[model samples]
Target: MKQIALDIGLTPEPTLAGFLAGRNAEAVQHVRLWAESATRSPVPSYVWGPEGTGKTHLLRAARQALQSQGRVVGWLDTDTPLRTPFDERWDAVLLDDVHRYGPEHQHMAFNWFVNAVSPLHGKPRAVLAAGRLPPADLPVRDDLRTRLGWGHVFELHPLAEGDMRAVLRQSADARGVFLSDEVMGFVLGRFSRDLGSLMQLLDKLDRYALQTQRAITIPLIKSMLENE
Candidate 1:
């Protein structure tokens, strides 16, 4: 039988403030600043990095920031074909995971990049795109790959171990749970290390603790993991 999974929790917003930028602080600041201003320079940004380096988070945050100011923004991703080209009508555009895009998606994204910087547009527009490889190495058409370098291009680095721990601790505290040092250490050693997945794991642990009426301890976590 096919399993039916229900999404029972509220989806959290991905914002610049919530991200632990770590070594990618410069990239995060640049994207945030560009999104917050409509009259800023017409520099299109391209950010590329490993799969879990918070690329999608930055893209979503940028789009949300622009929309909050009543500026029209366009967002696209690899999961679907483009319905409309991101054009001069938008104050900014955020295109996520370009590496997963086939040829047609690149056509839309490339046009956006070109026109967002065209002198004929007469208005400031920013285009933000992200992929898993740098511009020169991205497996897209040569013309689109070349356009990705027109503005600020950042290659994000993974977070440090210390930053990961702090993220877990902060998230646990915010959830009204005491994340003990020993338990935290156990989690680090036994579970996924990426910050995004780590946060999700902590959320699961918090809910599990509540369900079982137990503190989130190493033994409790071990028991929970064993059932998986």
Candidate 2:
């Protein structure tokens, strides 16, 4: 059988302003400062946490923030191709999902770490990395693993329920949709609570609302789920 993709609405690009800092406010602030080129140190910034802690979100936000300032940044993750070696002209590098890297990615990441910290002719470039484990506990090569801890390391935590509710409301408002308290309570009670999952649900509801020419309500949500 062929798979049918859900018509989820356009997702708002991840931005520092859109991120709900929750308990990770310091991490967010650090990333903001780093992206602004305010941090003088060449040491990399590392963030680690379980899934749904917004590790990828922070990385992408930093990337956008840096590029907006006319800085060249290279982004790498488990999915991004690693064909070229690290270049000094790039102002920064972002490595996502460091915990899941295989041997090849580990080697490439090690090179990125080394070159980012100690460029030959110019000022050192910043490196930002994220993973499921802290640098000390990462399973990558020992040398790369040690370098991951050379700078700031932050452990992100899941958002609080209040924070989650605020985020849902904020997202709904941004889309010009009214999410009732009833719908919010029902959705939060019924589905996965992770911000990633919740945002996806919001996207689907937004699309369903547009499709059916109706406001998002508990019944509409149920209908969408039932139709699936």
Candidate 3:
């Protein structure tokens, strides 16, 4: 099989460790449950949700768990060309950012789907991620859209305040910084109610902390946020 190189550029590859460390308990539990079900049936699974809702995190976690079981896994980006060859012996496949793959790419994705689901020698299981529901709802071929929905689907919801706080604290701890509840509340109260934005804020704070060599405190966070 000829491997195609999808132009992912400098985008960071998803990691189970980082995702698990940042994810909330509910999301973790849901992914674990899905993994259990997937092992028994070994059918395609779909996960969708709003941006910053941790859809990618769950997908990556599931991929890692399956890999640890010695299952062969392949990843495809719907937005890009199918750069990676499909391993007939693969136990699973993960397609991320499916919405980004438009009509032209849909042709390739459709072909990949046929190959993946084919009853050949050793076809791999599959999992797909998207920002919306059915593929038809997206700008994809009707056949591809129908094929995408032919599996179990899970939609990850946004994090609650407590969950968000937990994630912030965990991320801070991972960076060897102490974040007081006061600081956490101050940051959350002022920032957008989304993990992505919160994460961006945390990144800035971390950089600031490094530069100043100071602990993450409410005053320091305020100063940083204000400066930005």
Candidate 4:
């Protein structure tokens, strides 16, 4: 996937809408705190959590919020090249999936991270999102691991059943689709509880409904599920 920089002026209204719709109060609070810290801190912070826990979305939201403040924020996907150096140029850095970077790149990331946090003439703040906490048996340098542990680490908990329903409803509403309670129950009962799977299933259903000109009723959902 291409690394896109978010428009700084964008209000992050869409992200807020999704958070409200999903009733993710904790995430909302975390975003607020991260924005505040990014402005004041010298070192970068890490937001670590399990897979499918909305870490990516929160990171993007933080980027949007920071950019709106006229800060020069850059996003680096650890799976991609870390071409930008941590000099006096950037105000903040957002690194996604930092755990996935290979050995050499991981070292480079670590050095860049230290420089960003260093009390030098031009150091930038940083925010990183990872599937797990750093220094946990991953193939990362020890110094890098220690540096990653320096900042605030917030773990996004898995959504409960009620929260899951809210997330599904929010996702459907965002897509201009109505997913009924019965259909949702059927999906939850039959499919994996992971948010990634649920979102993918919703995408498939949305496309299938559009293509077939059918409402996403329980029967239609069942038929689609059966076919799949």
**Which candidate has the top score in lDDT?**
2
Per-residue lDDT of 106-184 in model 3, one digit per residue for the tens?
A: 6666766777776466534555545555555766678877777887666667877887888777777765677888989
- Pairs clashing within candidate 1: none
Show where candidate 4 strays beyond 4 Å.
1-17, 20-28, 36-38, 82-88, 134-137, 222-228
Cα lDDT listed for each candidate: 0.77, 0.86, 0.66, 0.67
- Residue-level lDDT for 150 in candidate 1: 71
Lowest-sum lDDT 10-residue window in model 2: 1-10
Per-candidate alpha-carbon RMSD to the true structure = 4.0, 3.3, 7.7, 6.0
Write candidate 2's Cα lDDT for 175-200 as tens digits.
Answer: 77999989999998989997778888
Which digits, one per residue and each the tens of the lDDT, describe model 4 over residues 77-153?
76555555555566766767766767766766766676666636754566554545444545577777776777666
| Weakest lDDT window of 10 consecutive positions for candidate 4 | 5-14
Q: How far out, in Å, is residue 75 in model 1?
A: 1.4
Number of colliding residue pairs in each model = 0, 0, 2, 0
Better of 2 and 3 by TM-score: 2
Off by over 4 Å in 1: 1-10, 82-89, 119-124, 173-178, 203-215
Quote the lDDT for 78 in model 1: 74
Which predicted model would earn the best TM-score?
2
| C-alpha TM-score for every candidate | 0.80, 0.89, 0.73, 0.76
Global fold similarity of model 3 (TM-score): 0.73
* Error in Å for residue 114 of model 2: 1.6
